[model samples]
Target: MSNESSVAAEQGTAPAAGASHNHNPSPNHTVSKDTRRRVVTASFIGNFVEWFDYAVYGYLAGVISTVFFPESDRQTALLATFGVFAISFFVRPLGGFIWGHIGDRLGRKQALSLSIVLMSVATFCIALIPGYATIGVMAPILLLLVRVVQGFSAAGEYAGASAFLVEYATANRRGLYAAVVPASTAAGLLLGSLLAALLSSVLTAEQLNEWGWRLPFLLAAPMGLIGRYIRTKLEDTPAFRELAEKDDGVKAPALAMFRTYRKQLIIATGAVLLNAVGFYVILSYMPTYLSEELGFGATESFLATTIALASYIGFIFLTGIASDKFGRKRMLITASVLFILLTVPAFMLLDTRNFLVIVLVQILLGGMLTLNDGTLPSFLAELFPTKVRYTGFAVSFNLSNALFGGTAPFMATLLIGMTASKLAPGWYLVAAAVVSLIAVLFAAETSKKPLLQD
Candidate 1:
């Protein structure tokens, strides 16, 4: 016990035996496989539910446009829907700074617990809001208000969860464990897509616009309740606890990040662009892409996206294990290179309208997305010291997601409209991959390092 603290001192506040909680210390130090699995599952649930709420909105955008913007022209309504979607992302940086400060200054557990509560309430409220038929202009305004809550909370969820998971993990297995976050994200999206597909199949188009779109949003309540319980019952992560025990945490982490860790912050943000745009566009935005520009029909697109996302969840785990062995830079750089080489061909193949080909194309992009995303959270966590770890991860990751990821679908729709070419979106994806590729190539390999050693 004393020796453990001494070792922590030697390593500059290494993970303590556990926090000051009354629970068994077995879960804290020398983490048994069962302990690891249980802790990972707890942190993983909140992230899963958060992404589910987010994806349900993106997946139901077609119905949402009809319900919320009935008076607008088709394109205009669609634009407005996606525009609101983007607004949610735009507000995330504010959430990041607020939650990041709490995480760094207070504790990871506080930030993690509060975020799920906000997400649950906001997401459930979206289902209850009246459509344009009932409230006219107020419908879109109310929807926008709910989405704003969603964005604000989401900025805290993933970044905080990532820090939580990585901190709770055994040093060597950090990548494997952290991959669960992104995997959960895929699982959530897959669930949303499956639900959307089922609703589209069973319900009449009129029924779907009227009520079917509300079902997935309604599920948010139960899922969020479960997620919040899992997180609240668990203790805070060992990394944050060690910092707290030593009184080593920063006061204004967001500002300290700007003054001291600007270079790493910029690099991490650049690397995050690959994940933000690459994952969001391919999964969250693809169904709309398929239904509108590709003519796949709603059911076909939803089902295809579900299958692809299911595959993505599997690939994310595999890629995470590979990154631990092969190094993150190799996987990240390779992902970008492959994106540049294969994007146009993939888009061209997608234009075929064959369900089998479409599914395969989506699976390809999903695997490509996993290559970077599976490794990113842990990678970003390792890039900064504990004092500013949460702030650095939150700011860099959420800012990139806000600016690049949030705008991806809207940009894709705009690119296609402006150029009248399906290939334009692919080119955009390639461009995002390239920026991340250059950043990864210049960055040093970090797989073998200790947590937050930088």
Candidate 2:
């Protein structure tokens, strides 16, 4: 069968009748179900493990802070701990450059495989580090170094996987497949929250601070291996394959991308800020925000986050389908307006100290974020052409994410520390949303075009 016939067969319907059917403006062929499944599996597993570490670090901030920086005051210790958390993000740009080069020059498969391996090694090494009481100043220093390695590897993960999904998926259904990336991230955060809640629920605070915090980090090794295993089973994306076959790889992808696509990079970077900051603050920073700042117990905080994330996961696919059916701008704009209007009120509700109310507020925030997350990866992937896709996305996404996304927790903590207000983080969310709103206003709809030609 021809490529068009294959796309129709895979989709099983026409574009108007089914959201997953071929809608590409050009004739870019996709693979069969089995190959598509392999592509998705390879993409999903790596992001799952990457975000799992992010979740653990965010959720266990209090315990980690106490164990690693007991010499400091409550606020100072938490700040120091989140400083470590924030430090990882700073390394992402460097990782993006390295992995982006590998991805653009060599292949996505190699970059992905190497990234997971490095991330896993870093997590396990972090698990083995002695606490401050055991090793003095070297403990935090060692922890910082491990985080740097993890952050570096993670820089390439979401962008690379996104390029994979976008390149592999049918024209009409890229959003649906891309939903897996953020959904897997949510799953990782949920698993981390659940584990943290369980550990805190059963163990005494002293025990948790001393030994229990190590369990999650230890699990990172096996999970990373699993991610690497799945990724190695697949070849590079079709777009990359086309480039490779033609010997069309750029000489210096980073420099070439900047020289050629600087304007597109700025636009995509602005659009990405909403996802990076909103996701980090809501999912990664919420547990800490509730327990540390709002006087909730760890169980209460984790429960709230878990429920909200579970809801977000369920809502993501529907939003993905909607973005394809509707338009990218509509979905993103709605999310931004909701975030801007609802943030201060939601933060106010979180201050109520009522369990049910907290869950409700989180659900509201999670829904808005899911709309953005569901649409973001594919939209960002579509902004650049095949040759520069990985580097453009990696550099732009990681730069925005590292500066704003990764530092969200630290920024939130700093804002609260400086202002003595628990609701200060909500304002930060507002600022990010407003920026996103402007970008979406400027961004053209990316639903039906061919990424290779874009």
Candidate 3:
């Protein structure tokens, strides 16, 4: 059967009822169901492990501050910890170019397999590092070194996993398939939150600072091995394989992307701002915000974020399905607008300090975030052709994330300190939403389009 017929057969009555279909014969149309399942699993598990480490680090930032930094003012130590976090992200843009080349020129699985090893190894090493009391200044230096390695390794994960899933997805269901990326990401954060909450509740502060923080980082070794093994067992994405057969693959994908797809790179980078801010601010940073900023108990703060993450996982898939039906642009724009309108109010509610109210506010913010996070992988995958897809997505996503996403917690803390406004983070998120709303408005709708090929 022809590719068009195959897409129709897979989609059933939806296409028959006047839905538009792409005329090109996409390799994605021929991916077997079993292989697709494996693709989703590999993509999901790899990303899950990568983000789980991030979640643990972010959730335990308070404990980590005291462990690594010199004895100083509490706020000063916290700032130092977050500084390490932000400084590590500075390497992501470079990692994007290097990993993009490997993914685009060599193979997605190749890059992913190598990156997971580096990420897991670096994270596991953090478990063995001596504390400030043991090694003085050298302790924080080791933490910074490990974090930079993690930042570099993580640069490729989201973009590569998205490309892997989208390239293997059916033409009509790419959004739904790609949603697995963010869902798995939240799954990782959820586990980290639960672990963090449990540790905080049971362990004394000295015990947590002295040793409990190391346990989560230790899990990264085995988790990384599993993720790497699963990824290596799978073949490269069909899109990358197809591109390799066409020629030798792009010799310099980053240079080619710069020359040929600058416009797409800009839009993608701008569009990612909302996700960068929202993800770090809403999901990762909120635990610290609630506890440190609002004076909530550590366990309660984590409980709030944990509940929100659970609800977020459910909302993400629904947003993915909605984007497939309605459009990527609409879902993205809606998310941005909601943040602009409601973020300040959500922060206001958090200041109320009621546990139940805090949970509801977190859930509300997380739900708003789902529209952007769930839809972004597919939207970005559709922005470039197979030739530069990996490079384009990786570079743009990481560039924006490096500048805005990773620094969000630092910025939020600094903003409150400098401005003496608890609402500073809310305004920061609003500004990001406005930027992204404008950026996405310029983007072309790609939901129903075939994955582009050279």
Candidate 4:
């Protein structure tokens, strides 16, 4: 092949002889359809398990506060619970560096397998910790410690899974494949919301605080085992394997990312701001917001969120497909613009406190979010070359998430208290959207191009 042909082949405009449509430029490394199916499954499950644990924690934050903290003041206890939640995220940036090294240098499979086990173990441990009555000050302390482990483990899951799927995907359908990450995440949240609703309705407050909250967490053990087994059985992604074969993989991926790709790192971190805030605020924290802040019934709040999450899962696949057709930058920009124009109105609708209207508004917010969330994994994956893809994605993603995303719920509550306004979270989301819009404007479109392999 001539130099132009080689470049064209790499860009997917032309193919090297015998290179499968489902594979990249490396003809010898064609990924079979069966393998692709399995890759999707393996990539989806670990993220599912990781987010399920997080969803359960967020949904049960109220019960956990009462169980782990002294109930001298309701607001104080709830703030303490969310404080532990936010503090745990501070460990994620460090985890990003560690897992990025493993994924970029060693293998994506290794980092994913290890992270899932640690996440599940820490989550399962949360179920066994004694309440404040039995453990005194140790209860909250242990809760925070376990949450930190969970946060650290979860740091690697999203970036590794996104990289694994995108590398294995056909160039034309990478967006759809990458959307599986957010879909699985929403699935986990849906299950958590349903369980929360069920327990809150069927069990008395005493029962929920004493024992019911622990039940969902115990499922993490078997789920982790299964996620690990599936991930271990798979080989590394074709991109990683190709890099390894060429001996071109980076040795110090995190360092290289900072030194070589500072602009991409900055853009990626900024672009993630909206996802970090919107995800936590819309999907994870909304139930707490509705029930606690709006004085809605817990069961009703969970029901509304459950309905929204279900719609979100469906909307995600469509957004993924759309990104493949329309381009990621357009879809992302659309999401940001929509959030800026409509978030305050959405929150205004929620303040009316009507059950049906709240459900509609939540669904609307979730659908708008799909435009951003569904496209983000692929966009982030495309930002860096194969040499440091995992590191770049993880570090930038976790940095934004740690600083903004993890703190969103706490910030929302604090803002509401300080401003004496019910619309505080809405304003926060708008600001996040503006930041992301500016970042995405700076990004180059990667949908029509092939994966970068350096």
Candidate 5:
């Protein structure tokens, strides 16, 4: 039989037999067609809301600076805003710990619902926060507090969502199902970028600085609510249900992860560095690079990024679907190698004044980043058993992101300023890609194995 036919046969047989052994309270926990659809949609929306809230800060950083830190010099205020952006990352590990523990102990659905609630409340609070003139120094202070909350919530969203999808999906479809989470992330970025562009187009810069920026943050509340509803309705994953039934779920998953899966943890963390750094560089820093270095206007930068973001969303889905058919390791290795080779040329092309060349570079760059991102969840999740899967995945992914991803734009700026070179970040990109390539080349492939069979 072909892979598709074999997968179909296995999915049909396993769920019926597995359901009898699994102890999930919901009858819908079986791997039926409807169950797979529900799981994929729930994971997608949950990740979408998490990233949508996070991406808005980068897209609207200039307006946020004007509103919350109005009294400072414009440059200083922008620095403070980006600083707060970086500060939020420090809270991710805490979020990861809390959500990972809960997910391992209770269930992925509950953990996901709590994360969305925290993120939505944080995003809404930012929308309603008074400007500096109205609230004095408390405005920025309050902003930082809310950002920490957002960071905390975000820590668990991806890991939980990925685990949820992976455990619920058929083994043959793991790569495809896992890809949806990152695809949703890219979708969120696209949505956030489009909203920022639309607002920038319609409003005067002064008006946007004063009030328009809050609209996107406020928009997150509804998305969060919808995600919460969908998540709460989801049944726990089959792997978790089976583990819980056996009383095999780790009580202190984080501790267990450190003691037992330390090597896998390191490998997973290394794997994320390239994708995390490249993602932030392309998505978050590109606008600033265009506006500050290339002398593009704010509106023009937004428009350019918006177009690139749309292309990125399409490429994310394509790369993700392709990874399933071609094997995750092969696709990831190809992406990392291509990224290492293209980093210089891509940046140089981006530096050109021709709009067509810039757009083409952005599409290819976005696609390259998507290559690893689409496959990472399955690759990392498969590195550990179910007992510490959530903890292992969360800690490794978030720490790398905090250390590398969160600082990409900030470090790139400092590097360019010090060197008087626009392409200094290419060196950082190449170094990270090299590390990721080494890790992927050495790590065992898990695409063909059953998720919890180990």
Candidate 6:
């Protein structure tokens, strides 16, 4: 079927025979059983590919440091590698705004497809680019350019996918379906970490630095192709379709969000701080911490993080199921409180020399982080009406992530350097978690609310 027919079919029958808007009982209209399942699966897979492409950078940063800045000092080379990481984040808000508009106005399916394609091309380019030895400064400059493209593409991947899944699901299953986004992310991180570890183990350090590092980035092309195919088969969410039919879809969703949903924008931004900060701390930075701070080799650090992340994937789905059973607010509250209390202790324990203690700390920390990660997508998505849900979610999520999440490792390193103390970054995590807890208290409980009812 054509895209227009698919969108029309997704909108369902509008309010049957002149029924009043208030009288329409189905808040998101109605979705076919098959459409609903396809949307969820497609959302998960698209997000998976996006994250896998983005995260391979961090997992392979050491090799990237060598390739991109071959003659630079060790610190300078590492800084250049992370500079590319931060550069990607800087463009996320633009990605959020542009793609969020498409999601809100045109359709979520289109936005999802667009993001995957952009990310796939960017990742493939990174894999194929010549090194500093061959191309001088142009190599690193080109790498930076591709990273910007990645950041822009990834900006919409999570928020758009979550909003699509939540809008397509019944109210009772929103949390469970929304959790799929983060589950896919956790799965992606796990996959990337495992690939990095396996490659590092099988290949000598010289071989990995020389050429094996490109393999994971090249692999992203196929995953992106699979994601595009899955998303192509999926239908737009019922809520988005309904809004388009009513002429309620805003032409500029980002502007509508700032004008109409400003309060929600603030609250959602604040609520996501814990998710952004906590996730980056546990997933992206942990390997760095293990390798640099704890003096573990790269292979051991990867194994620990990979194991912890595998466990994190399980908790993500479990927390989502719990949110549906208990409520989103309660799960978030419990998570925030635990995170605030445990942040300092977890990091301190991780710093200890005992591997067993470090393993235990990782499990506890991963579980606490999962509490917010698993629920925030639905919690944030539910805060706004259909007309600006994507805008509200994408802008808030990406802005906070760019400002806080993307800078986490660099900030942590800076703080530790300045203080001569390893525990300083934990304070940052605790403080952010506290702010998130306060925001969660102010936001309304959305676990049982219908997607379009707000």
Highest TM-score against the true fold, candidate: 4
Task: For residues 171-230, write the lDDT of model 6, one tens digit per residue.
Answer: 788888999999999889999999999998899988997899999999888999999998
* TM-score to native of every candidate shown: 0.93, 0.93, 0.94, 0.95, 0.91, 0.92
RMSD of each: 4.8, 6.1, 5.4, 3.9, 5.2, 6.0
Residue runs of model 3 more than 4 Å from their true location after superposition: 1-29
Give all candidates' CA lDDT scores: 0.84, 0.83, 0.89, 0.91, 0.80, 0.82
In candidate 5, what are the lDDT values of residues 91-173, reduced to their tens digit?
Answer: 88777888889989998888999999999989988899998889888999999999989888999998988888888777777
Candidate 6 segments exceeding 4 Å error:
1-29, 70-73
lDDT for each residue of candidate 3 in 4-33, tens digit (9 for 90 to 100): 435334322123344333324345546689
Question: Please, what are the lDDT tens digits per residue for candidate 4 over residues 1-454?
Answer: 6443443343334433553222254787888999999999888888998899877999999899899998678778888999999999999999999999999999999999999999999999999999999989999999999999999998999999999999989888999999999999999999999999999999999899899999999999999999899999998888888888878676789877777678788889999999999999999999999999999999999999999999999999999999999999999999999999999999999999999999999999999999999999999998887888999999999999999999998999999989999899999999999999999998878886767665
For all candidates, the clash counts are 0, 0, 0, 0, 0, 0
Q: Global lDDT for candidate 4?
A: 0.91
lDDT of 3: 0.89
Candidate 6 TM-score versus the reference: 0.92
Count clashing residue pairs in model 6: 0
lDDT tens per residue, model 1, 1-454: 5433332343233343443311122434455677667778887788889999988999998899999987767767778898999999989988989999998888888998899889989999999999999999999999999999999999998888888877777666778888998998888888888999999999999999888899999999999999989888777766676667667676889887887667778788899987888887899999999998887889999988899999999999998899888887788888888888998899999999999999999999989889989999888877667777888899888899999999888888888889989988899999998899877765666665555422
Q: Which stretches of candidate 1 lie over 4 Å from their true place?
A: 1-30
lDDT of 5 at 126: 89
lDDT of 1: 0.84
For model 5, the stretches where C-alpha displacement exceeds 4 angstroms are: 1-29, 70-75
Worst 10 residues of 5 by lDDT: 13-22
